[model samples]
Target chain A: MNIAVVGLGIIGGSFCKAIKKYTDHRVIGINRTKSTAEKALKEGAIDEIGTHESLENADLIILSMYPQAVVDYVSRYGEYIKKGAVVTDVSGIKRAICPQMTELSEKFGFVFAGSHPMAGKETNGFDVSDADLYKNASYIIVPCNAGDSVVNMLSDFAKSIGFGTVKITTPEEHDRMIAFTSQLPHVLACSYVLSPCCPNHKGFSAGSYRDVSRVANINSTLWSELFLENKDPLISELDILIENITKIKDAIKAEDTDALKALLEKGREVKQALGE
Target chain B: MNIAVVGLGIIGGSFCKAIKKYTDHRVIGINRTKSTAEKALKEGAIDEIGTHESLENADLIILSMYPQAVVDYVSRYGEYIKKGAVVTDVSGIKRAICPQMTELSEKFGFVFAGSHPMAGKETNGFDVSDADLYKNASYIIVPCNAGDSVVNMLSDFAKSIGFGTVKITTPEEHDRMIAFTSQLPHVLACSYVLSPCCPNHKGFSAGSYRDVSRVANINSTLWSELFLENKDPLISELDILIENITKIKDAIKAEDTDALKALLEKGREVKQALGE
Candidate 1:
């Protein structure tokens, strides 16, 4: 199978590297930056640097661009993709992206399966990409009716690339789960670093402070794009968290130790209940 | 020098072990539970099991009990502590305990310099204590006129016990700094783990989820006491964080991608500005 990975950034680059390492797939690269493509080729992440013409022969195309770029890419190149070719993505949000890609695939006589690889780093680009980046991480598949062959192909691809689990759900479910599990943490970490008390962190910070704010050091521009694209579900997740936080905050404000303990106990119970 | 460590919990146990390992102080341990004290003695964390009479001859006394227990113990035992002896504690909050301790020390003619070791694990008690726990961590001292001698004494003690740094600050300042770095994070983690979406985390959680929620598996009973004892500063810190998160939440609600991106960028900047 010939797999073309678009955008040669961390996610796309990783896909190419893993496919090249684990399978006999003909990995082709399509990056906007010629330099990035050259780097991927030099690193042997891809067999060839692909042009728009390469979309016509790709058995599978993986879109690793940010969500907006993805919409734009499909709009521009959907007509050129080979009939019955499978298209997929590594975007964080899925509700907004999956349906549009699925529709475009139908009009263009191809398959579109939306994927959210629950793996990445603060660093970006092809140079830092690793075949094992997705190791022990979850890979979510949003059903876009790309057929069993395509779903199985992508599942195998994900597992071969080190995804610990690949589960299927609706695009909305993907966004919802990610909002609480992934997006919400990023938002919380970013906000946590901006806390007024952070200026005094020099001699004070320890494990919890470091742990809570570690993700605050993020790719701002990329995250900004991701946050805005998944607005609704992300908003709901934030509101739920804010409400929970406010409850505990109120207990502290009122010096209600009993209430505070109860709130924390509830929180403990919730975290404990996870994975059980 | 004779050193008495009250409470054979993790912190005090570690202190005793380190002092025994690195200094010539004759370490004595005071504990509410005789078994814990016996365990400390058997583990060689302390040279002797201490009684109320031990304070009469000790050159220094270190309280490692919880905040309320420290207050109660000091009030009960202040008269027994030898005049001119310096005392310190390893309590998490200071404003409530430090002032009371300072006043008690003044009344008793003993010096009280509040101390907080910025180190601990999620687990507690003497059985898990290690001499190296403070080797790379900060120690804050709230000086209460033990004079230069007492400050030097405590500073040397902290360093001798493998603390990375020891700095002096007012009790108010210590509480304020900790509100942001320590207390606020506990509150947020406890609260964050309580989000309505947490029940769905079985196969969805990843790195960020684990990072931010790590402290959600907490010592809630102890933390509730800490949170309420330093309620004012903690509440103020919580408010600041809520306001910041709300700004981002509002941007999401408005579907204002630019504003959301800008908020995230600001958060990224704050995190980046740390240590640079």
Candidate 2:
């Protein structure tokens, strides 16, 4: 099987590595830069460097670009992809891109199964890509115009590459949850580092500080696009989180132990419920 | 040297282990419950289980109890401690307890140097106690009424027990930094778990969710006491953190991409500055 991975950055480069390592698929590297493609080629992540004109030969194409870039790619290359071929993405948010990709898939007779693999690092680029990046991580399959057989093959591909679970959800549900689990955390981490106490936190921080601030070191250029693309849901998540933070603040200001204890207990209960 | 740990919980038990493992001190474990003391002894965390009467034999006694409980224990038994004996605490916050401890140290003729070890687990008790828990962790020696020699000895002792760095600061400075670094992170972790989206986060959650929520599983009884004990400093910290959260919320609400990007960039800067 021929597989083309678009945008040879971290996610895309990782997909090429995983596909080459785990399956018999002839992985092809596609990137906006020759340097990145050359790096992926040297890393042995792809069989050959492929161009836009050769995209129709790909039996499965994975769009590992940002949300906006995914939309643009599907729009530009919708008519060029092979008929009845399967295409997926490693995009963070789905609501904005999946609908357009679904329409394009239908019009072009290709399968655009929107996927989101819940794994990556603070570092990016092809040089940092790892074949084992997706091991024990989630890979959600957002059902677009892509049919069951296409999704099954994609799921098999995901599992073959060491994804722990392959879940199915709508684009709306995916975006809503992503806003809470992914997008909100990035916002919280970013805001947390801006605290007045951060400069003096040199010798004082431990597990909690490290855990909460790990994602604060993020890719601004990509995340800014992600934050606005899923604006409504992300804003809603921000509201809920702000309310939660305020609740703790009010409890502390009042010095109400019972109220504070109750809130903390509720939080503990929520943490228990996560069972992660 | 004879070392007494007055509370055979997680922190206290770990202290006993560290003292026993690193130095030739005869470590004695004391607790409100005899079972905990016996368990600490059986686990080799303590040389022997000691009573309040035997605390006078301890040349270096550590008050590894919760904030309110530590206050109660010291007030009741401060008179029984040995003259010129060095005493310290492994409490999370220092402001509420340090002044009172200083007064007690003066009256009782014992040295009280406040110490905050920035290392702990979500779990509690002697069963989970580790001797090397403090390795490469922050250990702050807060100067109260304790003399320079006693503070120096305490710092050396902390370093001997595998601490990464031994810092010296005023009680007020320690509390201010801790309010942001320690207490606020706990509050954030606890409160972050209470999001409405949490119950539904089964397979969708990954590193960031896990990172932010790691400390959510907390010792509610102890944390509630700590929060109330350091109410003033903690409330101010909470105010600042909530304001930061609100800033991001406003940026997202306004769809101000530049502002959002700047916020994210600042967070990245903070993360990089950590040098961890």
lDDT of 1 at A218: 77
lDDT of 1 by residue, B169-257 (tens): 88788888888888877887777777777777756778788877777767778898998888888888888889999998888788777
Weakest ten-residue segment in model 1 chain A by summed lDDT: A267-276
Please state the error at residue A212 of candidate 1 in Å. 2.5
Question: What CA RMSD would you report for each candidate?
Answer: 2.7, 1.6
Give a tens-digit lDDT track for model 1, residues A1-276: 889999998889888888888888899899998999998999899999998789998988899998888989989988889998888888888887877887898889988899888887766778788988888788888868777877887888888878899888888778788888888888888888887778668787677788788787778677877787788888887888889889998888888888888988887787777732
Task: Give the interface RMSD of candidate 1.
Answer: 1.8
**Alpha-carbon runs more than 4 Å astray in model 1:** A19-26, B17-26, B41-44
Per-residue lDDT of B1-276 in model 2, one digit per residue for the tens?
Answer: 899999877788888899889988899888889998887888788899899987899999988888767778888998889999998898888888888888888888998888888888888887787899999998988878888898888888888998999888887888788787788888888777787888888678788888888888887888888888778888887777778877877877788999988888888888888764
Q: Enumerate residue pairs that collide in model 2.
A: none
lDDT of 2 by residue, A1-276 (tens): 999889888888888998888888898888889988987888799999989876889998988888888878878878889998888888888888877888888888887888999988877888888999999899999978767887888888889999999889998999888888888888888887788888778788788777777788889989998888888988887777778877877877787778888888888888876564
Measured with C-alpha atoms, the lDDT of residue B122 in candidate 2 is 85
First chain of candidate 1, TM-score: 0.94
The fraction of correct interface contacts reproduced by each prediction comes to 0.76, 0.81
Candidate lDDT scores, in order, read 0.84, 0.84
